[model samples]
Target: MSEFLIYEQQGPVVTLTMNQPEQRNPLTGNTAVAEFLAAIDRIDADNSVRCVILTANGPSFSAGGDLREMKRQSTPAVSEMDIRQEYRRGIQRLPLALFNLEVPVIAAVNGHAIGAGLDLACMCDLRIASDKAKFAESFVKVGIIPGDGGAWLLPRIIGLSRASELAFTGDTIDAQQALAWNLVSRVVPHAELMDAARELAGRITANAAHALRLTKRLIREGMHSRLDTVLELSSVFQAVSHKTPDHMEAVNAFLEKRKPQFGS
Candidate 1:
């Protein structure tokens, strides 16, 4: 609903674009964070939204925290505790919301994803970057740390050693280097970024919505969960999937050598 985020729905796929190019689409300010949370809520409530492509319309995906806003808010009256509380109630919400959302999200990194912006991409289920894109876990450069769940999310995506190097050095890496580090799933030409992202979303959205959501949950749980626990959860989800009309249609259509038409 906020002008900071542009939400465009096309059938089962929704493209959430960060629209403030002049500011390089910073995520710190109240408006962007609130709009992002609201967008997640809206997507979660709409079953028709099977997939999401999070992209930014700018030379930078996001410059991370709004330093201008931070300067404006940084007053002698505001204690360290106040700043901590602000983080908990502010940009931190974006990672938590994206992580918990049932629908699959693909981050289409069109340009630079620095600091918390890098973590934002990590929060998504998948990431695709444009050839011109760059990434950095850059909090250390600004004399701060990754306060928006990057410490947890980054390690999970690219392993501890790589994540540690990025977070500690605050070095920027190009799209190819990101792909080599397993930070992004793929890299495309800048002009083709959206097309590649949409194609990936289409492949995901073609499946049964229920199965996709449940499988995503299973993957998320499996990340920090024991094998036996994940297996038990998977068994339950599998049983539930078996009972869905879409599952039956998929099986039947496979046997008949025809495309399956899934239903809600």
Candidate 2:
């Protein structure tokens, strides 16, 4: 519905493509952030939409931010308080929208993902990269920190040591290196990137939607939790999952020696 983002639905799979490729889909303005949050709201509120694939439509997935826009704002008299208050609302809400999506989000990294772009990909549950894709946490190079969740997401995706190395050095790594470092789930040829992403989404869509949602919630909350706390939380969600119709059908199908037919 919005020009800043394009939302497409095919069966149970949904795709949210960043449409401002000319500006490299920078997350600088209020419009882009609102459009992205709207996309997430659409995915979360639609029960028929079981999976999401995030991608862009140009040579670069995103160039982080509009350099010219930042340049225009840079001035000798600009106070720190003025800068923070100006963009604080947007910077705070964008990451929350990305992280709080109920359904699983897959990053279809098609090209260069630098600075905030890399952080956006890291927000997704899984990442599928095109052969031409390159990832970089270039915050340090620009005299800034990972303002958007890059500092938090990177270490969790890769190990602490590797994430530290990449963030500290601000090095650019190719798709293959990302796969090797476990940043992305897999890498496909450039021609097969979208197909591979769709295939993965399809596989996820074939399962019971309620179960998948609960599982996602479990994993997200369990990542930073202690063993005992996670165990308690797991039991809570698993009990709720067991009460779903699909769970009953799955049990009956197992007993009858046939495949479960999950409802949409």
Candidate 3:
């Protein structure tokens, strides 16, 4: 029911759209942030939802934080403590919530994604961008860092040297450059962005939901562990996978030379 975030369900794929196109979908507002977080929580609670496509309907995907709002909160000479507290309540919690989501998040960058907008895209498991899309870590130009987890996510995606250059210069990169740098998984013409994202979601939706969740958990958490630890973790995941009806059906179908039908 929130005006800021709109949710649409398509079988196992849930699409969450930023509805404030007039404001370019800024994430800094308390209402928008709370609504977005609530929508994500709803998606996580839905067992039938396996994937999420994050996108916006505006010419610019998002203009990042609403600097005007920030200024309004600061004009009264708000203390550092007040600003920090506001950030914690409104901005800092975004990345933490995104990271803890149980299902995969796919960012369909339909247009410009600057600063906090780029951070949101970075949080997703995969990014599919349109040719018109532009990405920028605009913090340096404004005398700030990419506050909402961009500093951590950028290096992991594109290596330290590139992340440093982008963070330091605050230069905008085109979708092609983003894809070449592996910041985005793929880039297509503006007309094809949603279709590409939907196709990818459909592919993921065809897989065993339980197996996919276990795989995602293993990959995300196990990548930082040692080989022995990864193997042990995989063993645990395999045991869990074995308990799923999908696994049994897959095994039976393989023996019968047939395709398995997965339950919703």
Candidate 4:
């Protein structure tokens, strides 16, 4: 329904493609941010959608903030506090929404993911980059910090030392380097990016949808939770999963030596 994002659904998988290729799918201004949020809402409401793939249509995954929009907002009329409020209310929402969304998300980085673009990729539960893709924590190059929570997101994904290097340098790294740093889980030929992403998504979608969401929630919680806290949460989630009809189907299928028909 959004002009800036193309949302497509195929069975249990949803693909959110950033459609502003001419602009390199910049995550700035109102349209991009609103569209992304709306897409997340749709995904959350749909129980059938087991997985999401975040990708872009053009050569660049995203160029980050729209420079023209930034320039427009940087005027005598808008104070520093106003800009801070805009970031808090605007682009920052994408990371928060995606991070909290229960569904599993995989970022298919097809090209250059720069500045907040790289941060966007970090928001996903998994990342798959193309061989031609490039990544950069480039906010510093533009004389601004990562206003979209990259500072918090990047360190968690790649660790403090490596994240510090990227943040300080604002230099671009190739797909191989990103994989080496564990910024992305896998890298494939540019032509095979979508296929690889869908293949991974298929693997995930084969499981029970409710269980997948609960499992994803547990993983996210585990990141910041104590071992005991995670254990407790895991037990609760496991109990919930056990109650789902899909869980029964899985057990029966295993005993019968057949593939489970989840949500049946």
Whole-model Cα lDDT of every candidate shown, in order = 0.92, 0.87, 0.87, 0.93
What TM-score does structure 2 among the candidates reach?
0.94
After superposition, candidate 1 runs with Cα above 4 Å error = none
* Candidate 3 wrong stretches, greater than 4 Å: 223-227
lDDT of 4 at 100: 92
After superposition, the stretches of candidate 2 with alpha carbons farther than 4 Å from their true spots are 76-78
Best of the two (1, 2) by TM-score: 1
* Highest lDDT against the true fold, candidate: 4
Q: What are the per-model numbers of colliding residue pairs?
A: 0, 0, 0, 0
Clash pairs for candidate 4? none
TM-score of each: 0.97, 0.94, 0.95, 0.98
* Positional deviation of residue 215's Cα in model 4 after best superposition, in angstroms: 0.8
Query: Once all C-alphas are superposed, what RMSD does model 3 give against the true structure?
Result: 1.5
State the lDDT of candidate 3 residue by residue for 1-264, as single tens digits. 677888899899999998788889998864777887888789878878899999998898888989887676667688878887888888878887877786888999999999999988988899999999999989888776677889988888998999888899999999999999999989999999999999999999888888777777776775367888888988988988889899999999999999899886
On lDDT, the stronger of 1 and 4 is: 4
